[model samples]
Structures are given as C-alpha cells and as structure tokens.
Target: MKNIRIVITLMLTLSITISNAGTPKNDKIETPNDSLRLAELNDFWAEVSRTVSEGDFEGYKATYHEDAVVVFTTGENKGSVSIAKALRNWEQDFIDTKSGKTRNSVEFRFSQRVGDETTAHETGIFAFQSNNGTGNDNPKQFVHFNALLIKRAEAWLLVMEYQKSKATEEEWNVLE
Candidate 1:
C-alpha cells in the first residue's frame, strides 16, 4: 500500500509539471523589444491617420496589404469585403478631400493591443470627422474597431480590419 501511494504521488507530480510546462504564462512581461515594436506600431497608425487627414490616397493605400479584408458589422452593410472594393467605394471621399472640397481627420484610441515582432491585433475606437473646409462644426463619428496587422519588409500593413460597431463618445472617452 505504501509503495502504491508513492507511485501515485510521483505520477501526479510529474503530470502537473508537464502540464505547467506546456501552459502559456498568463502574465506577460513586456520586454525592451516589445516596447520598441509597440512604438513602431504607434507610428504605423499615426501614418494612417496622417494619410487620411492629408488626403494622401497613395500613402493610405500603402498601409494595407495587397490581399487585405474588411469586416463590417454595423448597419445594412454588415458583411466581409475586400480592401480594394472598400477603397473603391471611398475613392470619391479621398478625391473630394484631395481637391479641398472636404477636410477629414481620423484619430484612434486603443483599449487593447497585443502582438509580437511581426503581427499585431489592436482593438480600439476611431473618431473620424469631416467638414466641407468650412469650420469645426463637423460631428465626429466614432466606431469600435479591431485591426490585424503584419510587419513586412520594415513596413506594417493592415491585413484585416474589423469595424465592429458604432461607438458612443462616452465609450470612446473611456479608452486612451
């Protein structure tokens, strides 16, 4: 009986150790490389915002991957669409902005960001505002969004964009 109990205890201990060895750590400690990569990701998003604000259509297009996909989960247009199709739909807006017919700006605030050296998943709210180059009376439209990006050849390009839903200003303010 004593030998049996010792064997059972040893088996349990070994099993526990093996299980733990395969389990991922819940608490992730940010390393220096992580911080640097995050900074680069921030710069990537800033470039997106800057391109939209300045009506740089070519620059904006460069932010996305060649085979990017966009998932729209709000309103009547709730479906997956190719990035090229979505860009075609928004081409007029870009043209208008570039022609000084409208001024637009987009700002992002993240609630969560997780990623490694080459891939990232960012969840956040984006506030897009547009005016007819008149004044600051344009209402800011906020949307909850999740963006999946991958770094390729020194450039971070969006692979998938999930526009989840419309977000209230209150919800937008809660995230920084």
Candidate 2:
C-alpha cells in the first residue's frame, strides 16, 4: 500500500539523519592516544611533586626520561646535576630537610602536540616551600617552567624542562 511505502521512506530518512548527526564535524577529533598523553603528562608531574614533597628521590627520578635535560632557575643554590645524578644527589638533601613541612606544588597547562600524539609541551608555575607546613614564616616562591614530554611504550616521560625564577624588578617594569 502507499501508506507502507511512506512509512518505510520516513524510517530510512530518520536513520540517515541520525547517523549523519552523530558524525563529527570538521573539528579534529582527539583520539584516545591524545587523552592518554594528557593524563600521563599530568600524572608525571603529580608524582614528581609528591615525591619531592615526600623526600622520595627515587620516585621523583622515575618520572624523567632516561636522557632527560633539566635547567634550573636557582642553579647556584640548588646545584646543577644530570637527571640521573641529580636524583641521587638530592635524595640525601631531601631526607635531611624532611623534618620541615617543605612542599612543592606543580600547576601546568595542557599544550599542543607538535607532530603526533606521542609528543607535546606544557608550561606552568611552581610553588616551593621550606616550611614544614603552611604556617611557617617561609613563603612559597613562584617559578616559571616549561617542559617537553615524549611518549614511550606505555609511558609518557619528561624529556626536558626550562626553569627560571620570577621575573626581576627590571623585567617586571618593562612589562608594565
């Protein structure tokens, strides 16, 4: 009957429309790999912060790439050491200073990937405290940092970092 044909046509049209609607627009779709990269990067920094605060140098070192490069802002005071050696050097220092409520807080923003989902960059600010807790006379110092991360098999590790202390008075004045 004509009614049957009309019903079939309507059903077909509805199905087509539904399928088309569900399809993504021209906007680039973020693949699952992209999501994993973001989470891995976040977790890497999180563990770094936790390890430093807990005085677990080994745990902190585990987040870095095998051949990672690090540039420190307070190099004179903090001492410059290779990624692998730095962890060992800092381990005793961290433990010695562990009695205080010292803490390190990391805040990073997601960045764009350069080539594929396997590599990306991020930047953020860090707050470091020497006080055992928030109530101490010591204040948290702000430092700016940028990091490069590369995805390895089942892991995303920090390959490099550029770190610096807060801008100087002259630098701040120039910006103003």
Candidate 2 CA-lDDT value: 0.65
Model 1 alpha-carbon miss at residue 83, Å: 0.7
lDDT of 2 by residue, 58-137 (tens): 66777789898778866465534467766665666567456554544433333234335778777655556565555563
- TM-scores for all candidates: the values are 0.84, 0.60
Candidate 2 at 101: error in angstroms? Answer: 7.5
TM-score of 2: 0.60
Model 2: clashing residue pairs? 100-132, 101-131, 101-132
**Model 1 lDDT, residue 69, Cα:** 98
Q: Supply candidate 2's per-residue lDDT for 155.
A: 73
Estimate the Cα RMSD of every predicted model relative to the unseen true structure: 4.2, 10.8
Over 132-174, each residue of candidate 1 has an lDDT whose tens digit, in order, gives 7686648998999999999999999999999999999999999
Weakest 10 consecutive residues of candidate 1 by summed lDDT? 132-141
